[model samples]
Target chain A: MNILMAVLLLGGLALAAGIVLAVASRVFHVEGDPMMERIDAVLPQTQCGQCGYPGCKPYATAVASGEADVNKCVPGGERAMLAIADLMGVPPKEVEEEAAPPMLAYIREDECIGCTLCIKACPVDAIIGAPKQYHTVVESHCTGCTLCVEPCPVDCIDMLSKPEVLEEWTWSAPGKASLVKLEGDSDARVA
Target chain B: MPGLLERLGGLFGGGVDLRSLISPGGFPGGVHPAQMKITAASPIVQSPLPPQLILPLKQHIGQICIPIVEVGDHVLRGQKVARSQGYVSAPVHAPTSGTVLAIEEHAVPHPSGMGRQCMIIEPDGLDEADQSMPSLCDYLDEDPAIIRERIRLSGIVGLGGAVFPTFIKMLRDQRHPIETVILNGVECEPFLTCDHRVMLEHGDSVVRGLNVIMHAVAAKGGIIAIEDNKPDAVDAMREAIARAGFEANIEVRVLPTRYPQGGEKQLIQAVTGRQVPAGKLPLHIGVICQNVGTAKAIHDAVCMGKPLTERVVTISGDAVPHPANICARIGTPMPFLLAQCGLRDLSGVRLIHGGPMMGERLPRMNVPMVKSTNGILAMRAESLYSENAQEEPCIRCGHCVEVCPVGLVPNELAWHCRNDQFDRGQEYDLFDCIECGCCSYVCPSHIPLVHYFRYAKGQVAHIEKERAFAELSKARSEARDNRLAREQAERAARRSKVRKSGAAEAAADASDDTEAGTSGAESGEKAS
Candidate 1:
């Protein structure tokens, strides 16, 4: 009889603790992880689909869900890959492919047929044109994605390397050996 | 009614002792190196114009000017060769009558040692002046807006090495009315005595310029703050004030010599005893400070109708046998000035564009001296102390923290910067660092603490720019997608509505055909 009483009391205590836990979980339910958004924040948002995904957001979601590899973003290159890997707490892997140097798409406006295909092809709306109107790329917003280059039927679009302006120039990282080759006689210490 | 008591007590006068005013009430941290006022006693000498003058379009801190004169065009002295692009920009004037040689890239005096667009001119023998700039001789009675316009048109910028356009600083803020205008004669930087000579030679003009600035800002009181190390400058300035018969409104106050006491914020604190809040201007605290050199420039612009074509520069160092303060024209090459100061051999000397403390190392002697170039220092190899020493580890001695005028922890900031943790450096108030070099001077470890801070600041600014671009692109892409989706939805809705109307019309026709067939069948049955 004593054994039966002890067993009943212990079972009753366990049942009560389970009920409290269930109610507490419902009462304090959080909106849960925003891991995909965090991953998207690290992305360069080029939306070029070089990663085999439709856009940066879809790729971020795939990486967050472990459905995609982190090294597939070509435009983001190694920097974005490392950042994503760090966010996911995984070892960084080598990029699957190399990317071209930074470039911006320029349209030969005179040769453009004004079909507006490149405008529709640009994911960032960097190109602005209407049907039967010449299109020009707004260079500031152009992510150097090269998405609008292939859609031009007349072969008017050319991907040109971004020009260096004095305002955008910056000092390189301190103590890092710079690989900038000197041109002409522009030696720093002429004296 | 200005008095020593009123000047020491600041805008709000109180029965305060001058001793307490000089103590814990002034600017926070500072260091006193050797007061190398070696050329203070030398009279100003005029420098001959070089054969070619290279004027950089972007000498000031604001917008770069656009060249208005084309190559091969003749430009007269003080001619506006480059027009100011924006309200904050200063126009570049021809230092002397010359023909434009080329508009091409040339090396500029920057820490990066990079090339920028410069307008090269070959000066003719005649120094013909452009007298179009109107002189507001009665500037004291003129409207402040008109005076500001004259200042802008004359292309006058801060001659204190800041090179900020003076007109922008004079723009009045209705919320914080300026009370006191402090004339900063504190040439605290070692080896720089251009301001010292400017005060000694042109003290009356400086006083007159202070009056014009006072009129421009509509401030009642003006105090000329000079370092105590230059007693002659103070006496000269006082005599100038008395000669102008403005002694009742202007006072000359002597401050204890300290490095960077001439910094705009530090001078404000030292003179006014008010700490300008972080990320705020001295104007916010009802005070505006102008360098005494800038004041004299303003006087020249307003009274003499002169654009800023030349300035006083000090040429000093061990490399030169005779170090003298020379009145040099803008766009004069460094080598020419150094040669003028008896520096012929450039074999073993390092040339600095400004003072040794805050100046940058010139990559080449071909770079021209801009309007703000105050001192050209050619220190020999022995004078460069601890610059090439291998950086040692921080001992946490906190000496850098003790000397930082902004009171930022330089050691930790340097550590974060060295470790590539810029955000951590920013959390320790990295932007507050004025790049004063005080921390580097005091560092026992020989760490270039200021270099790290500058590198981190540049990196942080670049990263911020990239992040901003990314955000802009992301927003644009998202907006484009939403626009396309909305257009598609509207197109589909319109097509669906048309299809629905066609289906209704077909249904109506089918009903009519059925009714006719039923009527025909009924007639056939009746006939049968």
Candidate 2:
């Protein structure tokens, strides 16, 4: 009889604790936003549609809604893709092979004819010049969209590859065979 | 006192501070090296200006300042000679009154030995200071935001090696609460003692600067971390803190003398016992670290309304006749500095900037002293230019692992870096390696582990850039394909519509002809 009473009391206390926990959870639970602003913030503000979406915000929204993969943004590359993947609780996918060589806008100054057509075509306003004057490219602001190239009548605009500098150079990773060689050598008999 | 409770308490405490043992302050790891700070005992001396100053526009780590004065334009000391191009960049002021000789590209002090855009100033030796002075005291009563803007307008940056803009760091979000402001006084680099002398001479200003920084960030408290090796500096800072009546909020912490202990992450760890996570900043861990020299600069900018025109630099190493710290004006050439110290025989002397460890070897002495240059070292050729033997394979003795302050696997990272396998290196947390040279210092094989890591990081970044371009092209091609398919479908639909209209016209004509035929037959029947 005593054992039965003790078991009943313990069970009642457990149920009470659970009910309290549930009520506390309801009171202190976080309200998640339907839109993912954090993912959007991680994206480069280029809005170039290189991510298979019309704009960066749309791609961010798609990722948040699980309608699009996180690795679709090629301009943002692996870092952005990984960050988005981590935020959305998904594994980072291998970047596509075609997404190589970040392009830069180059102006053929001779053929420009001082016309500001490319300036209006640029979405980021990377091209700078007054009307009927030679225009220049602000390399930092240029998103390499190639939109400006299409509008130039003289075909003066071209996409150039960014030059590699010592500052930007990184070392390649050592091969797996080297590690195996190290392991094998260590296991070999000493002379 | 001899009760059971007392005995139990005694057993637990043992009259010792438990905090001192077992990962005290949670500092990850560090290295020990020769301190070589005996050259700073003498007072600071000034060096005569070079005949010509090659002042690079891109000295700091941001947009290059554009030169406002052209060739033949006369300038005075402390004058706004060059303007800041963007918000993230700092302005270049006239180090001394001089005539603008030229604005062209020249050889810059860099590891790559490349040229940068620079302004060549020819000093007239008139030593006339800029006459304009704006009252800074009036802004003391004004809004703090306005004061910060004033500081930014003055073009002040961190005088430390990392020349980050000071105002950007001060403008913090109130949501991310800052708990402690750490003033780094531990100049851990060997053969450099400029910061140590600054602290000894200007301890009051350093403390006041700490107060200003704390006020800017709304931090609860501040701590000045000095190495125990510099007892005199520590004592001076402690006295200054006491005199300011901030002994409680502002405390002095004496850290173990270690190489790269002055690094932002390592210093934060030593003071607060907090470990900044991999790929995160000290701000993320509720801490902000600034150099001692930067603190003094901040104090000057706030009180005197002066921009960063001059800084203290250490001129030392074995080759110099007189090794001393000099308060050098910006754009002062290294040759002039070496001449002041009486340059030793070049037959066996090798000159370097900063320190032997982590400092770049100078290609020529013509490179001007920039904001990041802390020391100008001239060592014996035998010591500085010793031929290193070929690197042998790692013995797996774990010396590099043991010395790594960030707890990263350097051996594995270096292996991956050497073989061009960047993905594997990233998996081993290659980004976390601070390039402190601890791994190389402790390695028995004398492998350049830091070099390997730097190379790996560059490769990974390049690959990332390439990948971004590929993705962009793929999207463009896909869009083009979609557009072409839609256009083809529309053209086929238009052809079908035209054919249907033509057929309907023909049928209508045939119906009219049939009506005519019926009229003709009726007329014929009437005639019969």
Instruction: Evaluate residue B267 in candidate 2 and report its C-alpha lDDT on the 0 to 100 scale.
Output: 85
Best by lDDT: 1
Model 1, span B116-145: residue lDDT tens: 999999999799998887788888789899
Worst 10 residues of 1 chain B by lDDT: B16-25
* Model 2: docking quality category: incorrect
For candidate 2, lDDT tens digit of each residue in B1-528? 235545654676766322322245646556778878767697777767767777888667788888888899999877877888877888777878889999987766665445678888888898787757463544336566866775676567777688887777776676667889999999998889989999999898888888878877778899999998899999999999989789889999898888788888888888888788877777887888888898888777776767677888999988888888998887787767877787733444556778766776654545688888889887766565222344678997777876788878788888888886778998999888878888877888777788788778877787677557445544544464576578667665755554565466557675545544554465445333
Which portions of model 1 miss their true places by more than 4 Å? A1-34, A69-101, A108-117, A128-135, A152-156, A178-191, B1-23, B344-349, B380-387, B490-528
The residue pairs found clashing in candidate 1 are: none
Q: Give the root-mean-square deviation of each candidate in angstroms.
A: 9.2, 13.8
Error of 1 at B512 (Å): 19
